[model samples]
Target chain A: MKTRRSDRLVDMTNYLLTQPRKLVSLTQFAKRYDSAKSSISEDLSILKRTFQERGIGLLETLPGAAGGARFIPYMLPEEAQTFINELVDEVNDETRVLPGGYVFLSDLLGRPEILKRVGRLLATQYINEDIDAVMTAATKGVPVAQAVAQELNVPFVIVRNDSKITEGPTMSVNYLTGSSKRVEKMELSRRSLPTGSRVLVVDDFMKAGGTIKGMMSLVGEFEGTVVGAAVFAEGRVSERVVAKYTSLIHVDTLSSDGTGITVTPGNYETEVYENNNLND
Target chain B: MKTRRSDRLVDMTNYLLTQPRKLVSLTQFAKRYDSAKSSISEDLSILKRTFQERGIGLLETLPGAAGGARFIPYMLPEEAQTFINELVDEVNDETRVLPGGYVFLSDLLGRPEILKRVGRLLATQYINEDIDAVMTAATKGVPVAQAVAQELNVPFVIVRNDSKITEGPTMSVNYLTGSSKRVEKMELSRRSLPTGSRVLVVDDFMKAGGTIKGMMSLVGEFEGTVVGAAVFAEGRVSERVVAKYTSLIHVDTLSSDGTGITVTPGNYETEVYENNNLND
Candidate 1:
């Protein structure tokens, strides 16, 4: 079948979007579309420009037979700020305040649209880093970690509070959780994480940074390096054990009566701008 | 900035891919690309044909001013079968067999590529159904549920074995589990699942469907209806209780000594084909 240029362009866009961070040689595209290599190269140049102008991502091409095109997932600074501001407003609602001053965020976290945006925003910050795995605590953090991992095209590892037989053999570590000073155990399957990995820690929410700290320690046990950490939201803590991390939103206060709350965008925007030298 | 046809095509494809199941009017694309409505229509025709040919999805174009294009994700039967066979082979390994005849699936479940394929395959089955929400058990089932929810573009609700205050007031139910006959409690937040919602239940694995049944009961407690249930893999159970469900893989045997195991593609392919009248 003779494939038209328009058809080839559409199919190529879909291919690149689905295969993010995967390299596809011009020969591969040429063979798949039954077109000349020159035609495929022209198609890719159009894709690259469109993607960049739309803030979809960066379509990087490497010259020579050993190289090809790779789609690096990214989010523009303006778009990232807009999304974070919207997220902050939605999270600032008094209705989301639960008992014990904990804010209900599962609703937002469960939305694929919200998760995708959060994933792109967070993943963009680590695009230049060599991240082997995205790690998170079980239950709540699973969605966030999965989202970020999808953007980075890497597998995510879920650390559990309790071991399950279904996980086979596991390696565990103990850490103190919260100001309550209660010790908690976190474990991961022995084979889930390989040694000497570069890990990115993610969580749905952080308070006192105990869980994040525990994940970092667990990573160390595997002889892995913590590339960085990010959380969807952060709560007030007198002394956060984890000093360096990125967050999308910070909850300033929540009334004991659960009728009032305040939230603002986290250091994510600032960090992203500083790292990439993105202008306001 | 005068928009070129190639740039418009690439941008339109990205827009449609990102906004699955969304009704995007031609005017939206036309305005976004600074192109004429007729040109946008031509671009969509190319996209529609290319999307169909590539098996990326079905680009449905609705007529009239109120009508527009909707991207319904799908998987070709041959592609689905190939993926399932690969998955079956990967899962049949003896190393995955754990104590108590349970298979270690967390590693596969944690993989974004595997999860994305599983999500699309399962979501394709319920594409025509009106699924308002996707529900799952806490811990293990969260990833599968999130992936499916992402494909369907709906919010997912996590049913927990134990209640957390962060989830707010929840509705709970007790269901008898396994041959052990232990009654276990399952709960979901009151606000997470609205009354009379049409929910799809998803899980990583199903032994005897006790957990799925528990999720169904919890859904009922919230006055919601279960549209369907799907599991990544299903194990043998004498006189299966939940008669109606779809599974991607069937674990026929796993030696108690954990040395040998056998697996096969489940009724998923058969059902999908029969439902769609797809030929081999």
Candidate 2:
């Protein structure tokens, strides 16, 4: 198809956004759009500048016969902070407070735009960590895991509280439920992950971190290593069982009467921006 | 950030892709890139043509003070067929066959890329429908619903076999399990969908269409209407309970011996392509 440079630039940007972290040589674009290689090169330069200026991501170009351009999707620290702050404000609604100090998150997690932003923020922290898979529990955590997996272009494995017959041979693990202080069993399909895989654990909410810890141990059962853990929100508690993790929002206080809640942005914004600047 | 027209085109495409089906006025883009409306209009013209040539989607413009551009993501009939054909080839594995003619699909549904493609295909059918939300039964159906919901920029509600107190008040229904021929109960949070809302039902797989029917009835309970129903694959059963629905692939035959199976692309490809062409 004959196309103008402006049209090619638009199409190329759309393609790169969808296929993040994928390398596409100029020849491929040249043939796809029936455009000259020089024109494609100029389009890439324009896209790179736009992405950088807008904090959309980094467009890395490799200069070799085997090389092309790869788009790494990330959010600037300021953008990340603004997103989390908006989320924090949204969650501060008293109507969201449930009994037993739990906050209603289904509505928030169910929105695709919110989940995508949260995924981008978390994935930015682990973009270079060589992640092979994203893992989460069956219900609430599935969306978060799927979002992160999409951003990383990897498969996500859902660990279920109950094993269905269709899953075939499964591995089960018992972990203490963080908020309830009760023992609960989680199961994963044996074929979901191969041995020696590196997995990232993500969830919707983290209180005592027992569920994340349970996933960490489950990763070990498959002979896989846990690269990192992330959560959309974490409840402030006297102590957390899991040692290291990143949370987008921190729930510092929740009233028992369901009348008040206090939420603040997590440490990811500062840590990511500072780390990225230091590396640069 | 001062950006050139080339840069503005790239950023604008990225923004429209992420926020599909939403209206963005030309003035918004003008302000975002610090460019004039005339320039933004020219850039949008380029994007519109590219999107059309690549079968990406429809770039609709509303010509008024309240008007702008909306990107509607879609796949052409040929592309949809190719995608479904590839999926059929992937699922045509002997190991996927389980006892009682059940084919394993958790892994396929878990992959972000696969789910995204399936979501886009299904969402395309209902893109013109006034869908308020997407609905599915947990656990396998959540990802499919999430994907469709994401593409539509709407919230997805999960109906659970078991109710959690955190969901607050819920509406429950009982339906016959397609494969087991046993009646089972499903429930959804009441607040998930408001009265008079229109919902699109989605699932990973269908056998007798019992689950989809149940979801349809459940939507009625909330005074909501079922816009449509879609599934990734459907089994070739003697009878299906649901009258109207769309399936991406058809599992024609599954051997109990787990050595032979036949899968084919479903009726969606032709229906969608023909419908879209007629609309055009």
Of candidate 1 chain B, the 10-residue stretch with the lowest lDDT total is B271-280
For candidate 2, lDDT tens digit of each residue in A1-280?
6788788888888788888788999889888988877777877888888889888988998765455799887878788878988998998877777777777788888999998988788778876778899999979899899888988888999999987867877888999987778999998988888878999999988999999999999999999999988888888887788998888888755546656788888767766676563122
lDDT of 1 at A12: 89
What DockQ does predicted model 1 obtain? Answer: 0.86
**Best-matching candidate per lDDT:** 1
Q: State residue B95's C-alpha deviation in candidate 1, in Å.
A: 0.8
The DockQ of each candidate is 0.86, 0.79
Q: Using Cα atoms with residue i matched to residue i, what is each candidate's TM-score against the true structure?
A: 0.97, 0.95
RMSD versus native structure for model 1: 2.2
Off by more than 4 A, model 2? A252-259, A274-280, B64-66, B253-259, B274-280
What is the TM-score (0 to 1) of chain A in model 1? 0.95
Residue B243 of candidate 1: its Cα lDDT? 75
